[model samples]
Target chain A: MEISYRDMITVLHGMGFGVLFMLAFSGAIGVIYATAVVGPHWPRSKWDNAMFRFYLISMAALAWLATISGAYIIYPWYRAVPPAGTADLSTYPRALLLSNPHTAGWHDVGMEWKEHIAWFTPIAMTMVAYVFIKYGPRLALHRQMRNAVLGFTAVAFFSTAVAGLFGAFLNKYAPVRGGPDIVLMREN
Target chain B: MSVEQQPTGSGAAAILAAGMGSLALGVFAFAGDAVPALGRAFTFWQPTGALSGVTITAIAVWLISWFVLSRRWASRDVRLGPVNAAAFAMLAAALLLTFPPVMDALQGK
Candidate 1:
């Protein structure tokens, strides 16, 4: 079946949003697992270590992919419009993707901070995964480094959570998509 | 050393694996956007298609990393602080420089 740009765009957005949610979920698990493994006499299993590292590496990588696809959908809208908060309310009350601001606010300013903040997702997650692996066996031994890793992981996790919130919000409202010379969708 | 004390593989392998994994994601996902020809090159449906691509890449990275890291271990304890740190630093640098915004800035007058 031929897919409209709307379907494709929506699907891509959902893909990124869903994957970001997964990333956050996996990241939370990672931090928990890492924390659990740390401390005296904690049972240490090599395979378990491998499993943890695998989770981190794979999730981080997948996050990058999702973000890339998400950007693919967003970039055109991002560039085609004027700066956020500067849009002409009368002519274009919302950004390119909003038929109206009430329902699908995410298509407008809802996504503004998300678009920019989303950049940090892959960067931070990749680092978090690396730290977990490099210090796989030593995390508990070094308190400061352990805390640092936890902090960074939290940030990455938080970032993914934010992306997910925007996604869920945007998707929930099923907002009208609009842009230069376009009005793909709008809720009455 | 006990099995518990020794991690299954060398830290270096895991480091490289993460980097390779991230790169795989970058190639598969970002290419479609940055280069229109590449995106159109394959008729991948959104979401599902994209998920499949990333899954393949993630599995490949895991297998390759495990194999390489295990082989490198070769019955010795390997503390990966310096080497892994170096690899992580390199990947971070590459990500920083190649990220879209930075790339755009570099190209713009």
Candidate 2:
């Protein structure tokens, strides 16, 4: 079936919005798991550790949401009046991909936003600093709590990296493996 | 200080293992035939972009760090101190540099 630019744009927008919702949904679910369902059963040390990490997770989630939101807006603007085809040819695949409508679109927008999620390392780092400021120097801080913090941080770090590859996979075969530009140029 | 103390080496080793595992998974996800199916867990659609070497490196680092920190062997327990702090800062800087505002200035975005 032929897809219109408008229709393709809609699908792209829907996918982008879906990811945003996923981020929100996952963030909320994680918090709920940490709080209502499992918070009470957790040891005090774990609770404190989790609470500390939770703030960081929340911050990182917001950062991701913001980036995706930014792309969702900026991308359209970029597409609407993209750089004129100087017809200049070069080797920068990344640059080429960015300028090419065939490669760059709402789908690309979604993929690119996912790609940038790794940017939250600073937030995570800042979070670590916050933990140190609030809980550090107190040598007697619960060992279990400390370990829990370490574990949570480790998990968060692990996930960030894992998510990167996951994002890559989606980008590599978007709209089906090696599919033509039919999806991009298809009319409604 | 106690015998029950976690060997720092083990932690680092664990991190390393995690990194390797992720790398392998990524290789399959990006290059292997089953990539399409595996990629579905993360997204409804598959990715068509190139695999990122930088991201792979980051995954390796995390894995190595975990392996070193979580190991039970002769403890090399490195504290999540200045080093990790510094690393995080650098990653953040790289991220900000890629933002559209920054890209615009550099590429005239």
Model 2: per-residue Cα lDDT over A161-188, one tens digit each: 5444444443353321111335434455
Please give the lDDT score at residue A57 for candidate 2. Answer: 52
Query: How does residue B48 of candidate 1 score in lDDT?
Result: 33
* Highest-scoring model, TM-score: 1
Report the Cα RMSD per candidate. Answer: 9.9, 12.9
Q: What DockQ would candidate 1 receive versus the native complex? A: 0.06
lDDT by residue for model 1 (A88-170), tens:
53323234346464644464344543543454466556656775766665656545444445544554566566766776675
Write down the lDDT that model 1 would get.
0.52
Error of 2 at B24 (Å): 17
| Most lDDT-accurate candidate | 1
lDDT of each: 0.52, 0.39
In candidate 2, position B67 carries an lDDT of 44
